[model samples]
Target: GEFGKVEEVKESLDLAYMIKETQNLFKGIVEGSSRSMQIVKDLRTFSRIDEIDGVIQFMCNPCGKLSE
Candidate 1:
């Protein structure tokens, strides 16, 4: 039947569209996760630098007081 053939074609096209959309969604998720990981990495690096700076300041304070 011609009508049956038309319906089958429509179903196939819909399935293809869904597959494409799903792939795009997954790609976006991966990109977003990568960005989030990078942000966390940067935050950790900044925190470490802040800790080092604090230690340096603490070590210098006693010397400053002795000089005063």
Candidate 2:
């Protein structure tokens, strides 16, 4: 019964083409994920630098005071 089912499935479609298409789809997903991660990393680094700059500027300016 199992062998008959396997033979019937095997006759239905091209396995090679399916495997190739699956591989290409996975490759694109991996590349896109990698690119997205890189962009997030760069954004974090930029935000940190901007925060530091703001702190430095505030410290350097004597008029930057808070009255409470």
lDDT of each: 0.85, 0.84
Which pairs clash in model 1?
A: none
Among all windows of ten consecutive residues in candidate 1, which has the lowest summed lDDT? 59-68
* Model 1 RMSD in angstroms: 8.2
lDDT of 2: 0.84
Residues 8-64, model 1: lDDT tens digits: 998978988888999999999999999999999999997788687786455657565
Model 2 spans > 4 angstroms off: 1-5, 55-68
lDDT of 2 by residue, 1-68 (tens): 99999988887867878999999999999999999999999999977886877864565565876644
How high is the lDDT of residue 43 in model 1?
90
Model 1 lDDT, residue 50, Cα: 67
TM-score of each model, in listed order: 0.61, 0.63
Model 2 root-mean-square deviation: 5.8
